[model samples]
Target: MSSRQNILTGSPWEDKVGYCRAVRIGNLIEVAGTVAIVDGETVKADDAYAQTKNIIERIGKVLEDAGASLSDVVRTRMFTTDINRFDEIGRAHGEFFKDIKPVTAIYEISRLVSPDYLIEIEFTAVVGEL
Candidate 1:
């Protein structure tokens, strides 16, 4: 049978982007790269730390919706506009995954879909007996 699928929260972008918050394929759950946007715009400008925290929290919702927690996460990918902000983003990333110690990669990008976004993160989790 096909794996169950669901959206974690009711974000306007879910329909606009045509993607779910998290999709479960068999035992794997793939989460979309989440930013700190609350409505249609970024909430805190230049606050990469807070933005990172917000993004991770939003991702938490997606993981929870799929019957998984952050501990289930096995991998993560982070995208940032400025490499210099790695300290801020890395600390935030570490705060969440410190216990799980999931494989992670951070990249510096020219820009994100939105200019205000400083950091974006996506996670891959294996639920149930991983």
Candidate 2:
């Protein structure tokens, strides 16, 4: 069996909560639920579209570090605090996966870890080694 690999972002929560940003085993990578947090604050706090876009871009980097790309993503799960914002969030998701069209699910939850955070996303991807 291939060895397991862990990807860490060194966020305090990773240590405090004992979780990393992502993990990869062979060709499969699972990125942890991600929030659009930058410099200790939520990005575009009130704009779901901007926050979703920013989150995807950050997730793209994490995937790249794990030897994969957004196109390699096979599934995505999104959680949001407002169902009314679905159109904006979906528009941002379509921006990246319109062609890739990965399987996905978006849920309108009551809240997130932070009140400023309107969404959190997770990704699963399988890719060949480079």
Candidate 3:
């Protein structure tokens, strides 16, 4: 069996859900769907762009803990409630992975865990041995 390691992001969900922000098994690190909520509050509700940025930031922390970086990410999934916010969300997502350009998929879902949440993102990265 492959050894596993957990990655944390200092979010209350880490305690409440009894799960880590990310987990590393072998060369793969899978991150959970991270929302824009920080300190129990949504960072940007009106601005989909800002919300996307905030969500990615949380996911970034998980990648860091797994000894991976955004550049190492091979795939990503974004969940949004409104389809109209594609441009806004896409812009924000592009800001970070501009150079690396990970394969990404976005979906306009009915709702999220909370109404205030505008976006949630999950990532998968391949970790290389040092």
Stretches of candidate 2 exceeding 4 Å from the true structure: 38-42
Cα lDDT tens digits, model 3, 13-127, are: 7899898878999889888888876434446566788788887776776677787788889899999999899999999888998888989999989999988777888898987
Q: What residue pairs are clashing in model 3?
A: none
Candidate 1 matches the true fold with a TM-score of 0.89
Least well predicted 10-residue stretch by lDDT in candidate 2: 37-46
Q: How accurate is candidate 2 locally (lDDT)?
A: 0.90
Model 3 alpha-carbon miss at residue 28, Å: 0.5
lDDT of each: 0.85, 0.90, 0.83
- Provide the RMSD of all predictions against the true structure, rounded to 1 decimal: 2.5, 2.4, 2.6
Candidate 1, residues 64-117, lDDT tens digits: the string is 888888999999999999989999988988898888999999999999988889
TM-score of every candidate: 0.89, 0.93, 0.87
Q: Which 10 residues in a row give candidate 3 its minimum summed lDDT?
A: 37-46
TM-score of 3: 0.87
